[model samples]
Target: MQKFQELSQTELESLYHDLLGKYKNFQEKKLKLDMSRGKPAADQFEISMGILDEVNSKSSCLASDGMDCRNYGDFDGIPECKAIFCDMLEVDPEEIFIFGNSSLSIMYDAIGKMMLHGVRPGAKPWSRCEKRKFLCPVPGYDRHFSITECFGFEMIPIEMTPDGPDMDTVERLVASDPDIKGIWCVPKYSNPQGITYSDETVRRFAQMKTAADDFIIMWDNAYAIHDLYPDQKVPLLNILEECKKAGDPTRVMIFASTSKISFAGAGIGVFACAEEMMARMKKLLAFQTIGFDKLNMLRHARFFKNYEGLLKHMEKHAELLRPKFKTVLDAFHSQLDGKGIADWIEPLGGYFISLNVMDQCAKRVVQLCKEAGVILTAAGASFPLGKDPRDRNIRIAPTYPTIEELQQAVSLLCIVIQLAAAEKLLQISPEK
Candidate 1:
C-alpha cells in the first residue's frame, strides 16, 4: 500500500511488470465491457415503466386547463406539467417552458437563438459580432463545450474548485470582456465532478456585473432531484430568484429534465428563465414547432402527481445507483488507495465519478483499459474542446453496467493506472 513514488527504482520496475502481465491476461480474455456514458441500467429504467400506463386508453386526455392533450397549440406547456416542474425547479409556472424529451435540444436551440438574434431581448445578435466567447468551467461537461464550439464561440476555460468554478477568474473575465457571451454551469451535482456551487458562489454569480448586456448563465440542473442518499440531499439557491433579487432577472437560464427519472429519450425537458427572457425564447420556439408533446406532458403529470412523487421516484433511482457508485469507489479504494497513482471525488448524487490520473498518463490509462477489454469516457473529455490541459481527468460512468461487470472493469482499470503511472515515472527517472 506504499505510495508508488516513494518506492525504489527496482521496486517500481517489478510492480510495472506485474501490472503489465495482468493487462496482458485481461486482453487475452477478450472481455467486452463498457463504462462510457452515464446511462441508466435496464433495471433503473424499469421502475418508471408504470408511467407508460398512466395515460393509456382509460385515462383522461384533458390537461388541467381543459386543453386536449391529444391536440396541439399549448406551446408554452400544459399547466399541469408546468406546475410540477415549477415545484421541482422552484420557479413560477409562467417562467417555465416545457420541451420534448431532451434538455440538450433545448440548450442547442437557446445557443442558436443567441447566435441568430441575441441572448437578451434587444441586444445585438451574436452572429453580427466579429468575436464571441463562452466561459467553460474545466473538468466540465463535454456536450456543453461541443455546443459552444458548434456556434464558433471561443471557449474560455475556467478552473473549477470544490465549491464551483473559480469565481474570481470568472468575474474578472466577464467584467473585462464584452465578447464573453455566456457560461455553462451544472450548478447542482455537476457532471463528471459532482461538486455543487457554494451559496456564496451562487450569490457572486447573481450579483456580478458583466460587460456584455446580453451575457447569459446557462444553468443546467439535470440532477436536481437525483440524490443517491435521500436523507442527505444538497440544495442549491434558486439562481433565478437570486438574479431577480440582484436586479439582474434575465441573466440566468435554467434547465432540467425527467430523462433520468422516467425514461431516457421519452421524458420531458424544462426550461425556465425570467418572464421577459422566457417570452423571447417562446417567440423563437414558435418558429420551430406548433407544439411539443403535450400528451407526454400529460402522461408525466398524471404519473408523478407532485414533487413528492418525483422525490419518491428518485429514491428508487438512488437505490439502484448507490450500489453501483459504491462498487466503483470501493474498487478504487481497494486497488489504488495509498498508491499515489490517482485521485477522485466521491459524489453524493450524479451520473459520473471524476477520476484524476497523473498528469500525461490519463490517455495511456484509458488506452490500456481499452486494450484490456474495458471502455471508458475518452481521456480529457471532461474539459472544453475535449482537451484536458494536464492530460489527466477520466470520467467514470458506472450506472450502465452491472456490479459484476463493473468489478472486472474497475479492477483492470486500476492495474492499467498503475502500469501507466509506472511507465510515466520510468520516462523521468534518472536511474534509467
Candidate 2:
C-alpha cells in the first residue's frame, strides 16, 4: 500500500471511498462494542474467584495480630495484610496504610486533606495559597489530572519521553515555583503510553530541590507487578527508599492496589510514606471512617499470602491479556504499518496501547469509529482538560473486550484511521 502522504489526490480519493464503503458496511452491523476504559475482562476475573471462598461466615475473621477482622480498629491495616503490601511496595509495615478497593479514592482524600487541613500541622492549608499548581506528564492518565483539577490547581504539562517525564523541566519548574505543590507519577508501566521512568528520572525526582517545603511526588504504582512477559519483567527503582535516602523522608507518597489482580470493586488499596507522615495522615483519615473493609483485607491476605503469590496471579492475568494485546498490535501491523498514517507503542506491561493517528484526524477517526458502532476513550482523554494539543493521540484499551471483539474493533479502528488520514491529505470533509 502506498503511504497516504505520497498518494496523488485522485488516488487518495479512491482510497478514501473504498474505506468509506467498508466503514458503512460496519455501521450496518449495529455493533455495540466498547474500548473506553481499562477494565478487566470477565475471564480475567475468573482466575481470582478463589478469593471469595478464602473468607466465609464460618471463618474465624481474626487478623494475624489477634485483632478481630470484623472489628473497627487497625485503621492503618491488619498486620498480615500490611506485610503483603510491604513486600509488594518495598516499604516497612509502619510506612503503609491499607484502604478499601480504589487507590484513586485514597489519592483524592490525600489531596483533599491537604487542601482542607494543610500538608502538616503548622502549614497553611493549600486552599488559602495564592496559587496552586501540579505537574502533569503529557499523554498521561486522565483521572490523575482530574484529581488535581478538581482541587483547583493549575496543571502544567510536562513532556513525556520513553524514559519518563522531562525531568529537566520538572526539576526547573518545581525549584522555581513554590506554588507547584505536587507532581503525578505512574512510575512503572504508566497508563496509556506504558513508559516506565528510568532510574535517573527516579533518582532526580528523589534528590531534586523544591521551593515548597510541603512539595510531594504522588507516585502511583498502579501496574507495579502487571507484567505481560514474566521472564523479561521491567524494573522500577523504589522512590520511597530513594527519598528517605535523600534525607527528604516526606517528599513521596506511594499508592498501589489489587483492583486488577482480584475483584476490581472489592480488592485492597494501600498508601506508603514516611512513618511520621503515615501517622499524620492517619489522624486526618480517622474522621473519614472508622476503618476500611478489614474483612476484605483479611480475605486478600489469606488468598495471596505474599508478594510471590501476587506475581503468580498476575502471570495468569498475562496469559489472558497477552493475546488481546496481540490482536490489536497484529491488526495495526498488518493494516496500518508503513502507511504513514499512524504510530503506536508495543507496551511490555500495563492495560493500554497508545496509538497516535495523523495530526488533526484523531477526533475524526474516533467519531468515525463511534458512528460505525464501536466506542473508544475520548481522543484527548489522556491529557489534562481532555484536550490533546496535537489532537493525535488515542488510548486503546484492549483488556475489557474479548479477543474476537478486539479483532473486529481494531480492524475498524485501522480503517477509520486510514480514511481520516486520506481525508486530511485531500482536504475533504468527513461527510464527503
lDDT winner: 2
lDDT of 2 by residue, 1-432 (tens): 668888888888888899989988888988889999999999998999998998898889999999998888998999999998999999998999999999999999999999999887788899999999999998899999999999999999999999999999999999999999999999998998888999999999999999999898999999999988998899999998889889998999999999989988779999999988988999888888999899999999999998889889999999999999999999999998888889998999999999999998889989999998899999999999999999999999999999999988988899999988988888887785
Which ten-residue region of model 1 has the weakest summed lDDT? Answer: 423-432
- Pairs that collide in candidate 1 are none
TM-score of each: 0.98, 0.98
Stretches of model 1 off by over 4 angstroms after superposition: 428-432
What overall lDDT, based on C-alpha atoms, would model 1 receive against the true structure?
Answer: 0.91
Q: Count the backbone clashes (under 3 Å) in each candidate.
A: 0, 0
Per-model lDDT: 0.91, 0.92
**Candidate 1 local lDDT, 123-195, one digit each (tens):** 7999999999999998899999999999999999999999999999999999999999999999988998999
